[model samples]
Target chain A: MKLSRALGASVFAAILMTGGCDTVWHPSIPPVAGPAEFPTGQIARGAELAAIGDCSVCHTTEGSRPYASGRGVQTPFGVVYATNITPDPETGIGTWPESAFRRAMREGVDRDGRNLYPVFPYPHFTRATDRDIAALYAFLMTRPAVHADTPPNRLPFPLNQRFVLTGWDHLYLRPGAWQPDPAHDADWNRGAYLVEAVGHCGGCHTPRNVLGAETDGQALAGGEAENWYAPPLQAASPARQGWSVDSLTAYLRTGFDAGHGAAAGPMTAVTAELATVPAADVRAMAVYLTSMMPKPAPAPVVAHAGEDPVFAGACGGCHGPDAPMMRNGAPSLAMSTAVNAPTPRGTIQAILQGLPWREGQAAPYMPPFASVLTDAQIAELAAYLRSAYSDKPAWRDLPAEVARVRGAS
Target chain B: MIRLTVNGQQHEVDAEADTPLLYVLRDDLGLNGAKFGCGLGQCGACTVLVDGQPVFSCLTPVSVLAERQVRTIEGLGGNAVQRAFEDVQAAQCGYCIAGMVMRATALLEHNPHPHEDEIRAYMSGNLCRCGTHMRILEAVRQAAGQGVKP
Candidate 1:
């Protein structure tokens, strides 16, 4: 009787442990059926749509087999490996039902009722239509199964626990398909959906808060990732290359922007896959991106007399009564390209680094006063320069400008 | 272990047979010009001359390079491509120049002078994100005696 009781206890303990293991080990959610069955054509369309989504970028290893996962994407908290989407029974999405896939893609939930971390970008995928989502499921279902089991994510202790994401989702996630604005043209609406939804271009291009959520109001207003700046997609963008629609299309397709900057870092991935997309879609994206321009405010001119004590005391020694003509290679404030550039970033850089004296050039060059000047003083100087020459408003905050400059440098 | 000849010089290195020739060049021989862009052989930033043909170094494993004479951007035609690069100001950040030059050099060696469509098709595999394609195209044309008339 004692031996039988002990055996029963051992069996119960094994079952409990196995169940717990299953809960943690299985990354996928239980499969759920779609609202309606997809046709064969829809599945094929989904394969193409998957390409539009650029699904291979995040999921595939850099040099290994395509879509077999094991790519480690770094986050603020930790690194997460993209799971296999191939139809491997043990390792990939072979067993995931269509509903589970939809839920994971749209709601950021996993099989087994656990909330998936937002790093998968389901927040943006939530905008995908039901038809499109079903198609994507069909396409994924058809891909050859590769039995590569990716290692578990290495997140910080509390963050490693999946429950925390429930709160995060509550605050940020809005689960639903994209609803077209009835007022807009089909092309415009299509462009908006493509840019905002499947493309998820903003995920990397937009500035984010400390929590890694995008600052919604400043959408596509530039961000920093992997030590490179993803420049703003607004009209105020100082395009190194001119921003014509045709040029933009070519740049998007080829990853070169003619006279503008090349895509680097994460953008390389974007261009490689994105460039291969339809030309019309590329043009639409350009149109939508170019349309977003922050309205220009009227310039405020602050008149400062030559005799103003503040200006006379601080700047007279170098600039003189009439801002001295840039001569002998000392960039005259009057003719300085650094000062005249459309954006003040170049001028700020010059001020911070100081004008270096060319060989056999003038000696009284602009000195590096960055160490000596307080943030306020620098702001005043910049304000004085802009007012005295160009009629542009001073950047609101000097410290932030300084930080951006320092970070870029 | 694989035996390879680079710029007509023979060498032997031990690595995973599947290791990309770009890694072999960068990690083994310390040639850094061929950058690692998208490592799936998508972007041609890792272009190098494989027996006088432009090939993506990232996808060409060292094992496949056994007994093959390889040429990098560094060893092309007395750096004629580099001169052309300077003449047209065909570099911005210069990260893509090496690959661009390698590809262009291969084009010139094969065709001497290629049409715009031909150039575009041939160079499509290589990406220049800086938007210097016009200047680069102009430079290639100039090298071919097509001049800057177009």
Candidate 2:
């Protein structure tokens, strides 16, 4: 009877220990269906869908095997190395189930139930539909295995702790796929999906607060990145790079507006990867960007100088009473685009750098006297020009302004 | 060892043959015009003329250039195209100018007067983040003359 009682006690102890164990061993991830069964056509479609996500930019390291993932992405909080997404069983997503992949892409949760930081662009990607997401998964699984291992991130104390991300997501994230609006056209809807889901343009161009949360109120407006301004994408963009649909589309495909501006900084990477994408998608992006332009405001007119002493003495030589003498092809302050720009930054820049003359044109030229001019003098000249020919305000700070233009040059 | 002819001069160098021609040009030959905007072959800042074709020097391995003639921005002709660039003031910050000129030179050599669409298609790889593209297009068009239509 004592032996029987001891046996019962042992059985009960084993059951209790097993039930309360913290280290539950999960089964190995099951293999996804082979690519052959999915049809090669789907894979090609997947490739186009993957391009929308720009998967290669962050996932692959320069000069390394593609998709191996050792690229370091630096955020304000810390640096995170992208993980190997290739199918290597030892060091990559080789064993990730399709469901887990869908959950991670749509909900920003890893297979281990860890909340992924928004730096991975899951905020925008959350809008991706399951069909497209599944296609992407199928595409990724078929890629060859790359046996590279990126080092773990080195985020600061509380932020470094992955558990804290759970609360962060709860406060900031809204988990769901994109919902098309009944009011918008098919083209606009497609554009929105491409922009908000696949393109993830806001991940960089949009302004963010100290916590790296995007300020939605200022959507597509200008922001700063790595000390350079990501000029607003809205219709009111001061740079005037996307004035037309053609210009916008051409800029997206070629990485330059051909007449207005070109891509720089992080945008350089975007354009490079974008070059490989289909022309149709690029055109769609251009249509989307162009449609976002607000109504054009009438060009602000500069007030008459009315015999201002500085212009009378120093400027009259070229900008005379009538028919402003074109020096160095110096654009007539009366009708020049540089004089009429919304912001005086470019205008001030032109003055400081001195306008370069057209080589074969008969226009007069002005040498850049930036070296000789004091900060106040440059500011005064800028103020004088803006007040006389344009309605723009003088730059708030002159030295700082000159310094910025000088730095860019 | 790789045998490459740069700007008509032949040199033999011993190194990892897979090293990008951009590095070989910048580090080995001290040709600094090919800026390193992105190490991947995406950005055309490292574009160079390889056998009269514009190739991304960053993606083209040094070994791939064995006995190949390479032309950089420094070697591009000082013709109407260069004069047009000066006329339109097409460069800002000038970081991408070398690459831009090289690409344009290649375009002009193949099609002396390319239309707007052709210009856009051929020069899409080069990136100018400064937004000076309008001036660039105008300069190219002006160089090729205004009569050419896309």
Candidate 2: what lDDT? 0.66
lDDT for residue B101 in candidate 2, whole number 0-100:
77
Alpha carbon lDDT of each predicted model: 0.66, 0.66
Which runs of model 1 end up more than 4 angstroms from their true locations? A1-40, A240-242, A294-409, B1-150
Predicted complex 2: DockQ? 0.02
Q: Which digits, one per residue and each the tens of the lDDT, describe model 1 over residues A1-409? A: 3443443344345445444334333355554332234578877777667766788877897554677899877776678888898767778877778888888888777666677777788889999988878889888887778899987998765566675555456556777778887887776677778778887777776788655677868777776554344666775454423366666666677655523433444555566676556788877777667667433233223344344333343344345434342221222353332343354555555555444322242222333434323444555666667667544455556566766765555
Tens-digit lDDT track of model 2 for B9-124? 89887757556778889998898988887654445787788877776676555665665689887665476667788899998887887888777877877788787888986776
RMSD of 2: 18.8
In candidate 2, stretches whose alpha carbon ends up further than 4 angstroms from where it belongs are A1-37, A295-409, B1-150
Model 2 chain A weakest lDDT span, ten residues long: A20-29
